[model samples]
Target: MTTTVGRISLAVQLLCRAGVRVLAVAGSANQNWLASLGAEPVVYGDGLEERLRTRAPNGVDASIDAFGDGYVELAIKLGVAPVRINTVVGFLGARRFGTRSDGGMAAATAEVLAELAAMIAAGELIVEISATFPVEQVREAYAKLAERHTRGKIALRMR
Candidate 1:
């Protein structure tokens, strides 16, 4: 499971390819694309737990909380052990529940980069580039990002 999956499509793709049943939690706007990414979309809102339970009655083995906002608590409610739950934006929750929130720094090794490169080369990973901006248009690019969910990343090209 993962929440607020902005920088997480690759992880979802990898997990799905590995035969893991992934439940991607995000807003309703992200549902369709998420399904295409091979994940069961769980929209964030009231009764989310009920919906998840209905979909996976056996419960989830682990969870990745990318955007916090009570995601850690929700994972605990779903019977996932704290040790198996990794969070990025939920440091307080991690301290409270003992969920792992080591952040992306630890996974920035060369080996991980090699794996990502291989996946991209093999067409197994898709990184969506929403738009590209020259350095002069940096402000405009940021304005676009502030709009939220451009459906991809905004690239700034250098000369």
Candidate 2:
């Protein structure tokens, strides 16, 4: 969760906070919801490239690869500079493509965390949860995550 999908979610929030336009690549289930968060939605899979181009006709300024599996390459193909691309999951791809292989470390800081918390507290940043599991159900929690269809974070409760 350091700089993976979790980090991508935060990055999106940061962008929205800064008023930067975002093109979020999500599945049909989450597309509208992502749009509600201020990101223009680009559905993942078939026609992804075309959709991205259509959404950002002026060209993408940067990229964040959370799901890996050739996205680093896709971002490169879309004309984003290697230095502007940061990835968490596509380590090998980042190395190969010369993209920054950071786990969202550039955006991490105590002040930022406090700001994010405030955003949530103020409802400025929408926090979606796919599931909530007790600490004892950690296995079940992980199983749900492995399904790869969650639209938001899954919570694990200590109690």
Model 2 clash pairs are none
* Model 1 global lDDT (CA atoms, 0 to 1): 0.80
lDDT of each: 0.80, 0.76
lDDT of 1 by residue, 1-159 (tens): 433232367777878888788888878888898899998888878998898888888787788877777888888998988988888778999999988998666888999999899989888888888899998899999999876557777999986
Give the TM-score (vs. native) of candidate 2. 0.88
**lDDT tens per residue, model 2, 53-133:** 877777888888888778888888888889988887889889898999886677679997888799889988778888999
Q: How far is candidate 2 from the true structure (C-alpha RMSD, Å)?
A: 3.9
- For candidate 1, the per-residue lDDT at 93 reads 92
Position 116, candidate 1: lDDT: 91
